[model samples]
Target: MATVLVIGASRGIGLELVRQYRAAGDRVIATARDDEGMTRLRELGAEPLRIDVAQPASVSGLAWQLDGEEIDVALYVAGVIDRGHATTPPTQSAFDHVMHTNVLGLMQVLPQVMPMVEATGGVFGALSSSMSQIGPVPGSNSWLYRVSKAALNMAVRSARFDYPKARLVVLDPGWVQTDMGGESAPVTVEDSVYGLRRVLASLGADDNGCLIHHDGRRAASW
Candidate 1:
């Protein structure tokens, strides 16, 4: 069975990913910030590691947690959304929280985990949003979130060069129904994670450094 590592798997897309992967009988190591989250992960048959990605000190311990295991699939799925638009300036606290969680956290995690992925010639996928697209820009509903994810896209793409053996890609999970997406979202969490797993399974050398939708459509431009 493939060994999978999911960073930030307490809820939403991340939690659902752990559930599905475990259901498929893969060995899953997932992270959560609190006791309750860890308990939930354990119940789902995942090896739970306590980690708050927004905190550098906490994230620093992840490498030791995994030790020497080679990971077949590693996903950085920790992120927070910002709803404020460009019409008003975002407060420093707001920007810091969003950027730290969405971009900086993943950046910190990569150094610790990418080597594990490389050892297995695995696929490393980060959850990004289509709203991050600059070309044919969508309306600025969550401008700060847009900026953070756009930076996330660049971070993963740039890091891909250093770990050539690992297939690194950014994935857009679509607007799935979750605490972040709300009830109005058309896509279900099950469907979104299913598609994402499919995309991860189908990664090729040429697919490296690309942004792909959950359904497998690749972005034409960054």
Candidate 2:
């Protein structure tokens, strides 16, 4: 079975992914910001880790804790969506918030995690969003989210080229019913994770640097 590391495994899509992977007998290492959040993952058979993705030292500390263990998959799910009117404080704060986790936090983990993933010939995934499209938004009110995710896609692309040996995947989890997405969203966490995990399980090295979606289709545009 594959050994997997799931970032942001506290709840919603991340938690479901952890559960499915563990149920399939994968040795799962899951991380979140706090003990309370990690407890659910613990009950689901994943080794829950306290990881604050926005902190560079926290990531390095985690690498130290693992002690050179090789992982078959490393999925970075830690991110934030800043909902605002594309105006003052809220948008500004949103930009900073999203960058701190989605971009800066990713940078911290990517350098360390990508090297380990390449060493083990593992799959490295980063959660991206269609809202990041340079084209136009399907809906309003997610301007900050759109910008941050677009930047994230670029970051993932860079990692793809940098880590040629690993299956570097940039994935859109779809508008799932989660805390960030709201209850009215069409897809469920289980549905999105089910498709995503399937893609992860089956991806080949040739698929590296690809942008894919929760439904197993290649996402169009950057």
Number of clashing residue pairs in every model? 0, 0
lDDT tens digits by residue: candidate 2, 1-222:
988999888988788889889889989999989878878888998888888987777876777766687888999898888776555455455567678888888877887777778888889889988787776567657777777777878888877878777888888899999998899999998899999988887887666777898898886566
lDDT (C-alpha, whole model) for all candidates:
0.94, 0.82
Q: Tell me, what's the RMSD of every candidate?
A: 0.7, 1.8
What TM-score would candidate 1 get against the native?
0.98
Provide the lDDT at 196 for model 2: 92
TM-scores for every candidate against the unseen true structure:
0.98, 0.92
Best by TM-score: 1
Which run of 10 residues does model 1 get worst, by summed lDDT?
A: 132-141
List pairs with backbone clashes in candidate 1. none
| Residue-level lDDT tens digits of model 1 in 1-222 | 999999999999999999999999999999999999999999999999999988888998999999999999999999999998789899999999899999989999999999999999999999999999999686878999999999999999999999988899999999999999999999999999999999999988889999999999999987
